[model samples]
Target: MDDDENLPRKTNDPLAALVKQDLDPLSVDELDERISALKSEINRCEAKKSFAVSHRASAENLFKK
Candidate 1:
């Protein structure tokens, strides 16, 4: 087997495209807006992660009883 088979394959992911976007053409205001949007997305992801963790812990506790 080739060593390349052990590596993860890339998909047509929107997040990956977003990260690769050319930002040099954007104005200062545009950059600020992009930063704000990214920050909001980060917060949303964190909230979902927190909820999932808590839910899993609850399930484990219930199963232990």
Candidate 2:
């Protein structure tokens, strides 16, 4: 038996779980609300990605000197 088998399974990420969820159960208004929330999360992720890219560029420039 593998040691990894004894460990508990890792849960799916929030985004992954969201994608897998049953949308049929939600009302039209609830679906709209979820879409808005997902959009904000996407914006937040994009900002973080931009910051990371900028930071990496800065680090590279510092090391090149």
Candidate 3:
């Protein structure tokens, strides 16, 4: 009477499979590596903005304390 009865199932179906591997938290080394990469990216953007601000001193002076 319904489309639900028409589906074919497999032993390897992703939705039906149970994960056998033990789940583990990310290691501190991995976390630190990601943090260091992010820091470098942030520093690069800050340096670029600093250079642009210095070049546009007249426009930037409006916000100076």
Per-residue lDDT of 7-37 in model 1, one digit per residue for the tens? Answer: 7657886886898899999999999999999
lDDT of 3 by residue, 25-65 (tens): 65889768767876898899999999898879966786695
User: Over all chains combined, what TM-score does candidate 2 have?
Assistant: 0.78
Give the per-residue Cα lDDT of candidate 1 at 63.
Answer: 100
The candidate 3 region of ten consecutive residues with least summed lDDT is: 14-23
Clashing pairs in 2: none
Q: Residue by residue across 23-52, what tens digits does model 2's lDDT show?
A: 999999999999999899999999999999
TM-score of 1: 0.84
Error of 2 at 55 (Å): 0.2
Using lDDT as the measure, which candidate wins? Answer: 1
- The per-model lDDT (C-alpha) reads 0.93, 0.88, 0.71
**Highest-scoring model, TM-score:** 1
Candidate 3 backbone collisions, by pair: none
- Give the Å shift of residue 9 in candidate 3: 39
Winner on TM-score between 1 and 2 is 1
What's model 2's lDDT at 37? Answer: 94
